[model samples]
Target: MIVTASSITFITPQVATARAFYERYFDTWSPFDCGWYVLVRLGKEPDAPEIGFMEPRDGAEPFRAGGMLNLTVDDVDHMHARMSSAGETIVIPLADNPWGHRGFGVIDPAGVVVYCHKAIPASDAFAPFIQKGPDVPRGA
Candidate 1:
C-alpha cells in the first residue's frame, strides 16, 4: 500500500494550550486552524508528519494517558537543553541505553509520552532486540 501522509491526533479539553505546548516544545507551528481542530507541522517540509489536536466533541471521552510518540533527532543532547530551557517536563533524562540509543522523554501537556532518540553503538544487552534476518525476530 502507498502511504501519502500521516499524523497523530490528540483530543484534549485544553485545545489551545495543547497546541501551544507542541508548538513550543517540538519547534512546530500550526498550518491549519479549524477552530476546534489544529494541525501542527515541523516546518515547510512536505513529508514532515503533522501532529494534530482537536477539542472533544459531544459524547467523546476525555483524553487519557496512553501510547507514545517517538521522534528521532540528530542530537538528543542539544534537544534536551532546548526543551529544558523551554520549560518542558523532562520525564526521562538523556542517556545511552543498552538498546543502542541515546534518548530522552518528555510528557506533553495532554499527558502523551514523547521520546527523542539518536542511534548509537549497541551494547551487549541489545542483542535480544536486534533482528538478524527477515525470518528471525528478536525479543519474541
Candidate 2:
C-alpha cells in the first residue's frame, strides 16, 4: 500500500493545554484548532506530518506517561538554548549519543517526552549498524 501522509494523534483531557504548549515551543508548526481536537502541521505542504491532540471520548483514556516524540532539527544547540531561555522543563540535557545524534528532551504538559535532535557522525560502535535504504536520502 502507498502511504499518502502520516500523523500521530495523542489523546489528552487537557487539549487546550497541550495545544498551547506546542504552539509556544514549536513555532514553525501551524495548528488547526477544532475545539476538541487540534492538528499541528509541520509545514504548509499538504504531506507534512501532523501532530494531533484530541480529547478522550467514549471511555477512551488519556496518555498517562512514557510517550516520546522525536523531532529532527537543523541545530540542536540553538533549539536547546531557546527552550532553556523560555523556562521549559528539560528532562535530558544536551549530549552526544553513540548512535549518531546530539539531542535533549523536554517534557510537555501531557507528560510526553519531546526529544529535539540533530544528526551527527556515528561512533565506531554504531556505524556498522547504520544502513541506508534505497529511497532514503544520503547524509540524513
Candidate 3:
C-alpha cells in the first residue's frame, strides 16, 4: 500500500493566478494542468506535496461548499470498510464513477468530505466489470 500524509487544499477564485503564483512566487513545479485543476509538484519523493491550490466553481458566493477536502488513499475499499465498521457516516456509497476511480466518500466528525480514492490499473480491463473505483490499470 502506497500511503502518505500530505496534500494541502485551498479555495481559490482564479486557478490561473493560483498556478502562476505557485509556479513563480513559490517556485513550485507543475507539469500537468487540466480542467478546473492543476497538480503542482513540491519536489519530494513518494509523490507527496506540502501545499496545493484548489479553485472551486462555487467559490463566487459568500457561502461556499462545506466539507470540501481532497484526499488520495491506497485502498479506498479497505479504508471505507474499516471506517464504516467504526460507525463512519458515508454520504456517498462505494462505487465507480465516469470521472474514473472506484471509491466512496464520508463526512468526518468535523463534517469534512473526505474522498478516499485508489488509482485503478488498466490491466484489469478484462475483469467482468470495470467499476470506476480505480482509473489506472492494475497489474498482477
Candidate 4:
C-alpha cells in the first residue's frame, strides 16, 4: 500500500516567523495554526499536509538530532523575496544544484527546517520521493 496522511516535522527556534514564511510563499497551502504547533497543507485535496511545525525545544533536538523537511515551489526567487521580507533567516540562497534543481533553505519554529525550492527546468525535483521500487511501478 501507499503512504497517506503523513506529516514531516520541522523543529524550530522561532515558530511565528516559520509560520509566516509558508503563508506568504506557498500556493493554496493551508496550515493548522495551533498556538504551539502548526501544520501546513501542500496538496490540492482537503487532507494533504506538505509540512508541519512542532513545539519549540530547549536545544537543537530536531536538527542536531536529525530532522528536516522539503517543499518544492514554482518560484524559488519569489519565495526568497517574501520570506526575506517576513524576516525569516535565509539558511541558503536559491541557486542551481549539480543534481539538477534550483532551491533554497529556511529555518522555522520548533527548530524545523523549511526548504522552499523549485526545479531549474520546472520538472520532477521530487523524483526521488515519487519514485517507487519494484512493488510500485513507475507507470502503475
Q: Candidate 1 vs candidate 4: which has greater TM-score?
A: 1
* C-alpha lDDT score of every prediction, in listed order: 0.82, 0.83, 0.58, 0.65
C-alpha-based local distance difference test score of model 3: 0.58
TM-score of each: 0.82, 0.87, 0.42, 0.61
Candidate with best TM-score: 2
Better of 2 and 3 by TM-score: 2
Which is superior by lDDT, 2 or 4?
2
lDDT of 1 by residue, 1-140 (tens): 98877888888777788788777656577788887988888666766778888888887775698688888888899989998898888998889998888999998877778899998978877767788787876754
Candidate 2 lDDT, 49-128, residue by residue in tens? 68888899898899887678999977889989988998989999999999999999998877789999999999988887
Best by lDDT: 2
Total backbone collisions for each predicted model: 0, 0, 15, 10
Q: Which residue pairs clash in candidate 1?
A: none
CA deviation > 4 Å runs, candidate 4: 10-21, 27-37, 56-65, 121-140
Query: What does candidate 4's lDDT look like per residue over 42-66, in tens digits?
Result: 6668866666666656654544534
Which 10-residue span in candidate 3 carries the lowest summed lDDT?
Answer: 59-68
- For candidate 4, the lDDT comes to 0.65
> In terms of lDDT, which candidate is stronger, 1 or 2?
2
**Residue ranges of candidate 2 with Cα displaced over 4 Å:** 28-31, 134-140
